[model samples]
Target: KLRIRTPITTRMTGCPNGCARPYVAEIGLVGNGPNMYQLWLGASANQTRLAWVFQERMNLDDFERTLEPIFIEYKKSKRRAESFGDFCDRAGKEELERVVNEFDPSQSLVKTTAKPRVSVTTETMDRLTRISDIRGLSPSKLANEILEQYIDSLETTVHAQK
Candidate 1:
């Protein structure tokens, strides 16, 4: 396991429909085919910026091997308290690509990338907190109910449109 200076956000989706909001994550992996994914990087930790495409079709099997060098450089050269996403933004995609391409696996620092997790937007979380407090319900329960309601509404709208 590699230790990072600050928490990094990672999102993975089965498709490129932005369902997981991968575009706003520091490390976004959108599955394009079996065992192949589109890699995105450079978004802010706060989800305020959009991550750009680092690779159109990276082999998922090579995920750790491909990112180890960049992770090493970030760990060694990043400014104090800088996050992985912030470091990626400052380093720029071209330079990061070069580092990845020129990396020697024999000099690997550590293996593995962070496991991906689903997350709600900050705004949604805040809203949930407020509404849950007023209704005396748990924030997670409220969030789930809201999501289910929203999905139902979307389905109704789609059926109406058709």
Candidate 2:
């Protein structure tokens, strides 16, 4: 097991509807079809940045095996206090792809089975559902868009102040 210095925010959604804010998560997994997912990585821990799609379609059975190279590289090369997402961002897509392509799973030492759990209150869900119905968008998608707009507005205000 790798001892990570910071918490990683991983979000998984059953569909592209993004009820879990997967786009902004450090590790986002969006189900594209039966037993297939779009793997995403590189968002900031604070949810300030959007994650990028690392793999367009990854088999569910290959999840742990596919990430072994990445985890190994992270454990060996990350800077002090750097999170998994930060490391991914620093490495970029090209480097990550190279590593994955050249990795020998037989020599791998990492195996992860950790899963994240999230809870939504009924009241909040009901509100989101109502608003989302009126807006013709998924609740999570609407919420994320609003959050992005709010963050952008804040940045604009800060720039104005300066």
Candidate 3:
């Protein structure tokens, strides 16, 4: 006899990008604002596919009501150990579209807008120079190595706390 672990799904809110990367989890909820959310479903292990935007700017009340049924249906129909992404794919595009549309008709027309590019400033240049001085390396060399390492460490520390 073999025991199987059920697929786990997780939700997070208030992330800057609303956790659009579906591959990151079986179910991911990203906050669009105070009472709005974006949904993502899937995992990267299969193919690194992203969840299609199911609904954009959904009110919290509507999200709770609409998502419950969809998840319930998924649980009922899903093959043993099937991930949400794989389930969606197996269920086909029409079914996924129906679910998204049933929750919010606007979902069909909603498009994710690209964020504006940021320009580096003189202040950033000075900071880079300071880092180079501290590391006893040229700006180009420090930029390639120590700067990324320093930033990555900071991010790691912050993420660890969360």
lDDT scores of the candidates, listed in order: 0.87, 0.86, 0.62
Best by lDDT: 1
Q: RMSD, model 3, all Cα superposed?
A: 15.3
Q: Which ten residues in a row have the lowest lDDT in candidate 3?
A: 107-116
Worst 10 residues of 1 by lDDT: 109-118
Q: Measured by C-alpha RMSD in angstroms, how accurate is candidate 1?
A: 13.5
Residue 72 local lDDT, model 3: 52
lDDT of 2 at 135: 96
Clashes of 2: 0
Candidates ranked, most accurate by lDDT first = 1, 2, 3
Q: Candidate 2 has which clashing residue pairs, if any? A: none
Worst 10 residues of 2 by lDDT: 110-119
Arrange candidates by TM-score, highest first: which order?
1, 2, 3
Query: Candidate 2 or 3, higher TM-score?
Result: 2
lDDT string for model 3 (64-126, tens) is 455554565566688877776677657764676576456653432223343344446889879
Candidate with the greatest TM-score versus the true structure: 1
Name the better of 1 and 3 by lDDT.
1
